[model samples]
Target chain A: MEKQVAIVGYAQTGYESDVDASREILVLEAAVGALRSAGISREVIDTVVTANNDYMDGRTISNMRLVEPSGAWLKDESKVEMDGAYAVLYAMMRILSGDHDVAMVIGVSQASVFPTYVPGVMTLDPTFDRERGLLNEVSAAALQARAYMDACGVTEEQIAGISVKNLRNAALNPLALRRMPVLTVDDVMSSRMLYSPIRELNAFPPSDGACSVILASSKKAAEITDCPVWIRGVGFSHDSYLTERPLDKLGSLKQAAERAYAAAGISDAKDKIDVAEVHENFAHEELMAYEALGFCGEGKGSALLESGATKINGELPVNPSGGALAANVACAAGLARIAEAALQVRGEAGSHQVKGVKTALAHGQTGLCAQENIVFILGGE
Target chain B: MESDGLQNVDMVRIPAVPVFNWSVGNFMERFFDGLKGGKFMGVKCPDCGRVYLPPRMICERCFAKNDEWVELPPEGTVESFTLAQVKVGEDGELADLEAPVLIGMVKHEGADTCLVARIEGPDPEEASVGMRVTAVLDKSAESILDILSHYVPR
Candidate 1:
């Protein structure tokens, strides 16, 4: 919101259940791909920001292996142990500080290397919650889902419908992992249930992925590309522990969105934004996000989905790149959302591209049941 | 980069299990002391009157030091629950449990917060929200595990 920063280029890998390449190579590919796409050499990059979780990576000082591949070897660099969207926010801030002209943000995760939900459980209060040994990410999500469905009168059928829509859209996304063009609500409902309301298909598939985006000051952006997606506004917020807050509400997302909207000078989000890329770890989360982002009234998310308004060709298409339900690689997920939105703004999102996307909103989240939320508003000049 | 199966394969199994000694400070020490006496204790915020099932050092809402400790009633109502198909071990890996378990969030009587624990006394599928439940604690216990196994429908 200070000095202007714009996303000049972005790239991401084809998300798979398991990538054959080493993480360093995967990171190098993404970092190099972005530089090539921007038609700029790494010499111009004044800083590099890497996004990853050390706990998830199973090591301390985790980015040491990735630093060189990320093109951060001799440059001013930092890391954010959160979703990639937050990493982009950090890069934008660095550019805005006038200390850096161009900053490349790279984020990655390999969910297959470990039981994906274990690290999530470790995030709970180790003194009691971990000692109790009953809750994990899936179980916590079940609690949130049940509370939300009970409050809103949402049904399992409606939750499955969300998966059907997103997975269906994924068929057109060459980079997504779960591309089921013929996936039906019945198929989704019949999937192995992880915890009651959360079925295997209803949750994000285990994926390995990396994504990169280059953020630069307005002057550097102008030199990099003719079509730069300006970072108009950004916002982020976090809620208290599971027991302290209302389980049915995504209060943090609403708070973050309000801050983002205020900074972007948008009074009516539904009319001003042309497209949106929401990060949903679970199918039910998308419905919750629709309400939290103010796209529809609270407890009316199911109705919003049923109205077919969020479809790829719908009034305000959301997750045209299929979203996390198709392929979620944790830290890489949020950056992928921003990259997909940028592609839409640049008219380069191949098969899933929306028409005339002047403004776009990208969302990212972390913690159990989306305890932390970040929103980014992007615009095309 | 083509692999010739066994010829190119080399493996090292360096499995590790980390152990840490956590300090359960004075606040949690008191709760444990209360648990050893066959009673459940919780912290009450003097300013807001909000009671935490697991005693808190400070009020989460008002940020006031919770100096008052209260005896939590054994009975409570279920707020939400899940029937877990799998369980995780101390090493943070999924362990095979013999049977599926019922977990619930129970808002203890006279407490503003809920406790997450195992549930019993009803079929997991039949464990409905708002069901009345009570803590089943074994008084002759050295650990929290023996102190409270699960909550049963009252």
Candidate 2:
């Protein structure tokens, strides 16, 4: 028999730049918010999972920073340096294994403290790539964007459509960092181009923020909230270590999506998935994800954007909560995706709410959208 | 009792230090040189028309062995980037760097890979995608660390 996992509580700090709080203070704020939201005390949490990178924090063993603030001083704590959703998935497995009943997963990134270019600098392989002075994630995405436009015949106008829609949705989200006046297709086209086919408006701004979620077993979930979102399925995959894969294909994400659909008993994703929260730090990536996640037929992702099928009022609304494209906090991105999806399922997504969001999908990508992909399926109970 | 004054002491001392010799190795050595020279470099897998930046010894996709070096153009655009206000050293010391330093990935021209580097221009707030920029190579040194230069938009 499979074990059941549910999201009992969740909390997040509004995405922003230059948070006045210290790292410990940030952790405490999110942790306390989650506990209060769940109507539970700290002692109820059986295990703790944290997501952060030592390199990002400029410290070795960065998990030590969470000891006091996260309240994991003497409990079972595990640090996942990868994506936060991956950490949440691990927490689910731990509960499924009967090792624990309640778990708290926290993800934070105080990037505002570092020099702006540090991440791009650190992303280099440090051996071969750093020497060649390679560009970071942005550049990698730009290459993919160019290749995608060439392969799909996508126009700059179509790419901007995604930005316009996301930004419009962001206007409704108080936590969104990039809410702007009504933007036009021309505005996106006219925006400063960071790479060919990618404009400044097409990417998410670097925001420093933190998010935390509380997971509980079925029984505990019943006691916690009236609207507990069930984790029907979870899947994660990693592609080839290098960025040399077919640009049009997201092999890892596809495989992970398939596994997640299978686990959730989903036969047809496009028809069943009502809402989707995808991690698209770059604009074109949103289109690529449409193909990779089986939301549309391969090579027809441009059509999905063209038809406005992914808009807030479209057949399948994507990123209704402004998404990573509006407010991107690196380590917290994946968890934010999951948290947003959970909010939709719980009917708690204010202002940016999508209608009839019964079953939602949350997807995350790491390492140039080529490796380290995760997919989670959440449903209203 | 007087003879007991001739007592002795036995002691042993051991000294150990954390090995901190972190080298960028040979493959990285060549790549960094290319950066300092204002050029981007990649290793091509002759078997499959794939080029890897921060050249890899082995191809990730085809598992093909890479032995040839290829130079890439320095011109590219920003893909995605984050500005960091904090700077951290290897020893976990936070450096008082400037408030916001632009760091992002630059897709090199005619290459399939993107390289991460520092963004240096007249105005960081003006940094955006599709803004034409060239890699300012460091001419003073020839190591991975030496590839330090800012991106100036054309």
Candidate 3:
């Protein structure tokens, strides 16, 4: 029989403007919370996985900060510089492979702790792209957003609707930073425009937060929680990093979602999935993701949003916990998405709960949707 | 293994093209002037079709060679854009530039490439996908970076 992997515990620090706590302290707080939630001791964790970027932290070998807090000082700890979902998936793989009975995955980013533009500046290719002083993530996404609009006819108002909805949802989430009393589509439309087509409201606030999840094998999971969210499928893919590729479509995300759906034995996600938490740092991306994830036919993703199919009370609620667009902390955004979905399946989500969420999908994307996509499928036992 | 000072330290004075000095005045003067001057120029790729705006010494895609200089058309479309609320220097020092600077990817007409530059003339909100923009070159500058700022829908 294949080894089963399940998420037993999850914890996250409330998003803040500036976390005065040290990086180690942040990790420790999350680790302790997860341990308490899982009702397990530190000894039960057989291995560790951490997701972070050195550029975000302004240090080389940034993983050094997690040694003590992650309980991996001398344990088998692997570091993934990409998204947290990648780390979570890797942890699941390790637990299923029988090399580890229990695993802990942690992701943290303190973008607000560093200089505002440092991470963006660091992302530039030092040789060529950096010389031109490209305005980091925002600029890259803007390019893709423009391309997407040009090719797909996605209106700016429709994209703004995503921000309005997510921010409105964030108002109900205690962990979100930019919650408002009332958010209207007009508010999003009138919000300060950062990039043409992408407004300040459409973009995620720079936040400092940490999130963690504990994974266990079937045997270990049985001892941890009766409502473990099983990791049925996981997929990751990367495409050409060069900007020369077509910017209109996310080819890599499509492929990764296909692989993940196949692995999960999900033939038709639209009918099978109960909830989805996609990484939409920019509002228009949520619409694009609908097509890429096969939630709807291509060019019909916006229609799904317009039809209220992805609302909290809709057929398939998306981002019930306020997505990255609400409280994104870069490295932690992907893992947070998975954790939110897992919480919904475990019936542990408070306030922003989705009814009968049995099957959930979490997606994590990096680098202007140029590629480096990860997908996960978690189902209630 | 013996340690020789010369072995670890190889000094090379490679031939280089100074693209733009890290100065707002210098960048604007060079880039804006390049656009007004009509003759569109980009750092040529001796190896392929890849072109670099604000010109680079090497091609990022292939890393093969980038020596041939070419004059390109000044027209392109707005890819995506943002209005910056703040500006800073290389050393993290704040610069005295107008807040909410409009920046975007300007894809040269009929070219397979795009560049990041200042989007001038139109309101940033009015700037949209497929909006036609041309290089507003400064006539006095010699470097390509002097003429890189993009102008309104033409």
Candidate 4:
């Protein structure tokens, strides 16, 4: 919070069910692409932070094999086993601590390599939930969806509308894996039903992708790029376990957003923030996040969706990049949100770009029902 | 870098299973004992007085140790439920069920937190929030799943 940090460059691999590339290749492509985007070489980066999970990678110390590809062979390197946005937070700390001027952060996951839902099951309370084997990611989200609908009058149709919007927006993002430009809510409703109210279209498609972002201190940012997107504020919070916590709302996201807003001197998010890129693992979560981020009053996420404020061309467009629901790459999904927000701020998001001139909000989440949440406020000077 | 004809060569399935043993602790041990005796038990926190099902050693909210055990009525209200039409296989693939199964989060009368389990005795279409259900213990139990067979509509 004391030092100014900015995103100098970013890059992502094309998301797909099978990227036809090994984990190392994905990491190498993203890292090299990000360096090229920043017009800098690996020598300029003082530290490298990566995001990955051992369980998901099917190997211990999953980042061990990714060092050379990440351009961190000899440089100071570390890893955060969370979303890529969390790794960015760590890289920002390295620069803010005066120990590093520039840092490279990468997040990657190859969902095609292993079972996507198994790792989710491994995160459950081992003695009860895991042993019972009754609850998994889709079922948990389905339970949350039903609870939210019961509490907030959110219909299955409204939840399906979210998928229709994001999958349609994904049509514009060349890197997105799922693109249904003309997808209808009825189509989503008719998709293969996994659990009650959670059709296949309402859930994230597992994909293989990687994303890398270059961060620099205020002094080094201008040297890296003239159009660096400043990190105005950031906050992260983790809630209680999934079973113990209330499912109707995102309590941790609310706390994280409040802290980030206060740090950025943003009291009115709806008016000040021009664009938002949110990580919604499920359709209903976007609605829940709207309330948590104070974009709307509690239990009014469906109403906000109906008001047309969160569409790609609306007043405060959310997830113009298609979000996780479009092409979720697990660890990279959160980082992709940051990349999308930066592009939006720079007016470089291509067809999905909102007419944004100043500020943007990007969110990342981990855990079932979004128990862990991070919010970032970005701005361009 | 284009391998247009190498789709099959790209992936190899490695089937590996790693086993682990976790200690359920004193509270859960006793709760399982109660289940074996056809009783539902929970731990009551001394400070917050919040009772936790699938009993735990400490209350998360009060940050205090739970020394007292409370016996709860087998009946509870279904706070929320999902009619699962598909099951995630061991390989994490979704397979359709021959018939739908009901999973409910039931808040017992004396407990603060809800217990998640399968609900029986009601069709998927008939299952709704606020439905009352009672636990049905198995005649012979080996695992938690066996002891708490399912919750049937009351």
Candidate 5:
């Protein structure tokens, strides 16, 4: 890398079932709020990258309508129809190329307006899976959950524990929508069953929100803020389609985290990383991610959870902001994870703040059964 | 702006129905032809020997054309399954089902990959992993839905 990149500023719209505001307004608020947080003006932004999906927006080239609100008007702007974490990756590359000094990356989604689960079906293999119509995000996750359970002797009760943990964590985050500070594992198990293993409480709540982050060269980041969270390392990987790939394990997430840990010089993640914010669409995914992210060994995620190691005040906390289980803003969830990690690093994550956080990991994923994954390692020093 | 809330907001629904004519290509065309003759057809990768059901043109792992066509047996083991209590409509809206449907990932006798299909015989609670099941083909087959009815306990 020619130049180190850092996150200077970040902001997120309040996560809700319906934010009352239009998509453009949400984008504008997040974008402007991020600039304000950085103490920089819109004119200082050299490039803008957005994460949005045309199908989800129910419109084609949705970013065109967002140009003005995103402060990307007449500037070098583009969009990636993936998680906002990927957009941040693009913005980092742009700054690293020396072609841009500062970049604004925004990820926005209005899951309320559209049929949320329909888009997951649209991402399937059009020829066979679409016609069969047997799989969607939740059902597919149910299959993976079942496979993981059978392979490792993980019980549904163990998976339900994750919901109890994260939703309880959401209570501290005022911006979070699904705050269940006293949620219990039995409450999750008793929640309406969608698929056999995936009950209603086990899945992410569809949410409407936007997240924006300002990335700059190290020199520019220093000028923007005193507490710039450095992007120590980043890695992303995509696996085969859902059916062809092994369902029991998150192979791509493991590969992505390995690459990131290598780049960040993290030989022991469970010891070195202080906090983690992950995008787990389902409660089981967080457990799967625990193994994939090197927080635990294979099939040992449940044991780690039972050990209370991932609790808010534990040795290594995960998803202290409640995670996607509380408020999944579609494309923005990953970026919001990054933002939450940055907040932790800056000692600004109120209520849910962990004491003495120096290093953090943020993860984002797309596709059914987490077919694609991105990992970012952040540090305050 | 603070005055705006969920109350009295104007909402308009736009009906979207787009049509697409997909070409299933030569490999599927052959597979369908084989299905018409009461045979389960799959393509084996020349390099990796991974057999893909609903036969594809290329193998992802080996990066080579899947030129070998293999005949798969109707019987397979259930790798995993779900008792679906909801059904997604054409517009992608989810609605509760009167009775749960047992859907399984069935890996055929000779194929490496699994095909997701509805399993008919077992009660949702009775269905377990590694249970042997056989394909119940739709005799007067027209489409994939008609040609392959559902799987049943062998």
Candidate 6:
């Protein structure tokens, strides 16, 4: 068996539309705050992994200016050009390899700094997809949404319900960017339609945010913090080309979730895991994720929404921090999910905290239609 | 401003536009060469017998080097479509078009993947799933955009 790893500390800045602060300040604040929370200084960190996108940053080597701020000064440092959850995965591998006892992962992005959808467009197949110039993140998501809705007989009202539930839940999360104290499905349905079934409120709001996670081996985790969220399992997978993969289902996410469940010895996710933090950029995807994660049978996600099983006070609460629909900062979104899931396991999630979350699942994805996926399972000591 | 926690903030505009000439690579080079000749091209994996539309050098599942290049018909069935209402401008604000364009994903016969392109030569409401469509090749086509301007119901 590989060496055990645990999350000892994490910190996140307020999710806002425009932070008006430099990227350096955003990264430093999260990293330093996480170190303080863990009761450890820079001297204790053996390695650092950072997640940032060069296209989004408008600068190459997005981590160039972040080495010092990320507490990787003179220590082994690397980067994940995708989502922040991948950075944490890399840090876990480094510690599990026994080469590093403690690792720090940081993910920071200011979505307001650049044209939000342009970066998403740049990731398309430049040879064909970009030359056509019709699809971006939202449009591609709409295409996927149309396919999923048509395949499963899911109505636009179901999609609106997800946005309403998540946005209303955001009111309880002080750090959420787009909080709605009172939101209704009717309001979400009446919002301007961006692409056929996808309404204005169904899409993720652009925001500036950053988050950090400190991982330590079991031996060091015990000494650093009394409340350690044990990293029980990890899994990641990438689907084929956008044009090639099936749009109706999250095939890659299912593969990733399966691997994670097998690793964590979770035979039944619906019964075993008490809470779930899914990085769903669009409202309809939260419903689709329930099916992909094996919480319900295929094409039954819409029925799951009506069952109210995923509510904050329901049988299994999902996205107690409101998930990415509340505030999606691109590279930072997945790490925020991890941070939220960790809090749930630690019994420190404040107002949105579930009653008793023993084991929790955190999910993240990247690329069009969530082509790349990663899943993590966290358990409390 | 202090109440919102944003005080004395200044903005700077740094203009950066990078020009890159990406290589079309070996397989794409062959595919475009066929396009230049007014022919639809796809490479067939000898092991799996699956034809890739934007022909890949190697088959993802079979792991076999695709050595057979096959000429495909220009007609396909519509897998999915959307009448996009809003478009994101360079400024990231939603922009409006005089009329929404019909976009369709057409899967060519003998091909595994759908080729996403604009649906032209038909009314937007007339478009439906599983409709047979043919690609109208441009005789003087220089790129993928020019080769097949749009797809029409066959």
On lDDT, the leading prediction is 5
Tens-place lDDT per residue, model 3, B7-100, is 5534333344234444434423443455565755556677676765544555656866566556678788776565665444654423334666
After superposing candidate 2, which stretches have Cα over 4 Å from the reference?
Answer: A1-3, B1-154
Residue B120 in candidate 3 has what lDDT? 80
Question: In candidate 4, residue A63 scores what lDDT?
Answer: 92
Off by over 4 Å in 3: A1-3, B1-104, B108-110, B119-128, B131-154
Clashing pairs in 4: none
Please, what are the lDDT tens digits per residue for candidate 6 over residues A19-110? 85778888998999899979999999999999998888878898988997898989999899988999999999899889999999988899
TM-score of chain B of 3: 0.56
Clashing pairs in 1: none
Sort candidate 3 into its docking category: incorrect
lDDT string, candidate 1, A1-381, tens digits: 543999998999889997776678779989999999899988999999999888777778778888889988888988899888999988887887899999999999888676677888878887778767788888898988988987888999999989998999999899999999999999999988777788889988879989999998999888888888998888899888887677888999999999999999988888888999999999999999999989999999999899988999988888888899999997899899999999999999999998989999999998998999999999988
lDDT of 2: 0.77
TM-score of 1: 0.95
- Model 5 chain B is weakest, by summed lDDT over 10 consecutive residues, at B1-10
Q: How would you encode candidate 2's per-residue C-alpha lDDT over A1-381 as one tens digit per residue?
A: 133899988888888876656667777888998899889999999999999888667667988979788889899998998778889989998988898999999998876765444566455455544444344455556656766776677777887888888888889889888886497889888876554455678877877888899999998898888888899887788886434455556778889999999999998988999899998888888888899899998889889888878888888999998888888887888899999999888888899888999899998777764467899999986
DockQ category of candidate 4: medium
Best by DockQ: 5
Name the candidate, 3 or 6, with the larger TM-score value.
6
Candidate 1's C-alpha lDDT? Answer: 0.87
Return model 6's CA RMSD, one decimal.
2.2
- Against the reference, the lDDT scores of all candidates come to 0.87, 0.77, 0.77, 0.90, 0.91, 0.87
Return the lDDT, model 4, position B26: 78
lDDT of 4 by residue, A278-354 (tens): 99999999999999999999999999999999999999999998999999998889999999999888899999989
True contacts kept of 1: 0.47
Candidate with better lDDT, 3 vs 6:
6
Work out candidate 4's RMSD over C-alphas: 1.5
User: Residue A23, candidate 2: how far off, in angstroms?
Assistant: 2.4
Candidate 6 or 1, higher TM-score? 1
